[model samples]
Target: MHGSTPIRASRTLKKSHANFYRAFHDYFVTHLPSSSLHPDSRSSSGPHHQLPRSASKPHTPGEGPSPAPLLGGTRDTTVVRIPLRSAKHHFGVSVSRGTRPYNEDTYQAGVIEVPAFAKPRPLNLTRAPANSPLEAYRAKQREEQEKDSGDGEGTSAESASGDPQVFYFGVFDGHGGSECSDYLRETLHETIEETARKYDLVSTLKGKPQTAAIVSSSSSKEAAKDTAGSATEPAKGSMPEPSISKASTLQNNLLNSWKTTVGGYFRRFKPTAFASPPETPTTSTVLTHAFLQEDLSFLLAQLRLSTHDTDPVRSDAPLNANDSLYSPTHFPSSDPQVKKSFKGGSTASIALLSTPTPTPFWHPSTPSTLYTAHCGDTRILLSRVSDGAAVPLTTNHHPSTPSESERLRRWAASFVTDSFGEERMSGLANTRAFGDMSSKRMGVSAEPEIRRIDLNPSEYAFMVLVSDGVTGSVGDQEIVDLVKESKTPEIGAREVVGFANEVSVEGDNATALVVRLGGWERRSEGGGGGMGTREAREWRKREAVDPRGRMT
Candidate 1:
């Protein structure tokens, strides 16, 4: 009787939700601003908005069945161009608890605006002697700027490529408990921004060109290398001089100083665990520090909370009501049964989008770039616009991988294959993750593998980040096909998660986060279903499950 009550309640809630959404959709259409309305809708003045002619008009007997409506059953292709990072409509997220008792997965999608690191003044080397290497380098730099400007190749600092906006999307899949994933969803991005700001400030103070305007592409790396190389090489039309190497040494010192500053920031948090930061820091280094540092901090916090040996109340002492020691929530537990249940681990898949400036209404001046930092088996895939093909942005970190096995050997840890033929390191499938303090000492790392992709709108349509629940049941190409054929990102995300849950035999929690990119809505001449043939076959053979987790 109790089980039936929940089932009945679920049906009622589903019906109510459907009615609410229908009413909301009607109200939104009636209240939409004229400027925001479709060209077809603008002609109608009444609160009752007219459907597109294709959907409203009856098909004539011989009119070739009339034109079918676009993907979402309307001809309106008008999309508001907001900052991609903060635009809720442009991003879609869906999660299903599946057959799990409770969900341990967490996700985050948002923008980080780094105003402090947006702009930096150019270093002034004019005061140096004419014969000095610094003066020669400055002259050559000015010459290159003139050449670029004259060739109409100058890039504006105010362009999207130079914008201090960072779009962050992350999925954390937890095992054992949700505490570790929850902690990361709350703190990781903020830590990254703080570290980046400090890195930029120190770079400026040490006379190294700041990275604010150059974080867009590999071009930034080339620019920085050129700047450093100029210090050692003789400037064009300048004779070889003894001071060139001296200037180069000065540049190296400047690089070290900035690295030192970043290192100091991490040391303040975990002085013993993080004794040294990378000498040459980049985007990858920043992600690595944030992941490892946060993991250590989280483990320490869990240890303190779970290993409490102090008495909750002292009979001899008069306790104030305001004191946490007297409160049930904060009172320490002296029970010997208190175990380290909070030492759960979570996989992290993070993507940072550096968008290119859109000019003349939706046409980008340059291609956008994506940087992904990932650990464990959570996957990040890019769907190409040309043929709707899947492009992998991260490889899974499993104990079965050759590189992972070798690394485990070095750390005195090895994968153990169970009777079921599943390879595990310290009883965990993934070799790297955010927590699992016990497994951490046995070579379970929190270090993420970083990857960069240059997203050309003509080639790439969208990107999806999915936890292992979805990846385990669905193929990469199948995921791309599902999102590609959907009407909108929200529907696409839901379909991805729903399909995973439907086909999954184990019924693990499933999550999908889809971010629409420059090439969104542009379909290929060839259709989509061809790539997802295998998944389609599997789906057909499986018993269909209803939304409420019952066989249909």
Candidate 2:
């Protein structure tokens, strides 16, 4: 009777195990589609038979049940029956047209491959002519390119180590129409790269005082000779000078002498006279401002030219379309009728991350850097995993801000209060943007506020670039939390977009780009202990009270 009792207990245990397996199988089948299951398992007749091949084999009494069958089989044994998704389509973008008739928001995020030859290098002006600043500038640029090419790190290094990748992300918000935003989405990065390269060359030339002095002296000498010749030759019906004015010549010689003296003193005292100084944001900021302003001006000019050609009435009409033909002061129309051509303008917010390569000149302590240029309401936020904080890296340029409001008032721009009590710059919510030629006269600028942040791999976690649509609906803490919780940047971006669409305000478009930084692995390494630190708690408390305070 005792032997029979042991047998009955064993049978009961087996039954319980089978029941548990059946319940798990049923839940898996109900929740996960057949496509998510292995093909062999899908064909099995019952829950027991649906077990993986490894589980089908018998297990010894002392050994644990052969590792429980996974929801999906191992990669080698099982094929992923699900269709593959492209990284560009999946990881790159997740956007939603919210309540707006059309999505006026445009965004771009991608890895840009930079060739070894394209890397920035110091220009050598050693062989540049002592005179002719423009010639010296050209020579310096040529020498820099030649030096870069001579480094012998082009194709071989690129093939072995792969091209250095620069991750670029941007969001453009269009107010009146999508044309300007669309245009910017396609060309802004290229414009920035071009502007930066030009600025680098110009800044390098400006840094060399000796070369500049030489050029300036040459220019002064040439001016003096021209003045003397003009005075001697005399203009038609003009009186000739009694003696060739030596004053201008004498001043040029004295200026040259002073410059030479100063140059020699600096060269003798400063050991690193030729070394390039540490980079600053001033040059980049100025370049960004100039590029944006010039691009907008070019767009306006093109519109005007096109309008002048297309409109026969304007072409044949007098200079001032509003003035009568008999008006005495009538002049040819210099400005184009671009207000009608461009109905809307866009706000541009761009972020660029440059990762250093393993070159001979590369410094081990020098970290990757992030550059941001913004002109509108879109935002860039940095999350440092060490502190568990969301740091706003941009300020929204709107008339609601005191500084912007003051600038608009100085420009004599008409302002109206909206339903939300926000001041509008000539009926536009944003004070700075590209296009909107009509509002430009009222001081609507396209000059971007550029910033640079050095990325420390130990502290940096991720960056978020988003349009106002997302910001309007989501708080900074919430965004950081969502991204922190996500397993991957692609998933994080999708989740953020989904959340924004779910709770976004009416008549807005939502877009988000999540960039995972260098120290993402540190989060997993810390096992959540990092987030529990005192500094992290403090950061969270501060964020809760005022998320937008530091940002504004």
Please report how far candidate 2 places residue 315 from its true position, in Å. 14
Please report the candidate that would top lDDT against the real structure: 1
Q: If scored against the real structure, what TM-score would every candidate get? A: 0.61, 0.52
Pairs in steric clash, model 2:
none
List residue ranges in candidate 1 displaced over 4 A.
Answer: 1-89, 114-164, 201-280, 309-341, 358-366, 526-552
Alpha carbon lDDT of residue 526, candidate 2?
37
| CA shift of 113, model 2, Å | 8.0
Instruction: Write the residue-wise lDDT of candidate 1 on 339-450 in tens digits.
Output: 3347578999998765322121112323555667788999999877666678897778887777777766656445689887989877889887887777765567676666
Candidate 2 lDDT tens digits, 395-482: 8888877656775675644688989888786678888788766666566666566555556545666778888888886787667666
Quote model 2's TM-score.
0.52
List where candidate 2 sits over 4 angstroms from the true fold.
1-91, 111-163, 200-286, 305-340, 358-366, 523-552
Each candidate's lDDT (Cα)? Answer: 0.56, 0.51
Q: Give me the displacement of residue 56 in model 1, in angstroms.
A: 28
* Each model's Cα RMSD: 16.3, 25.8
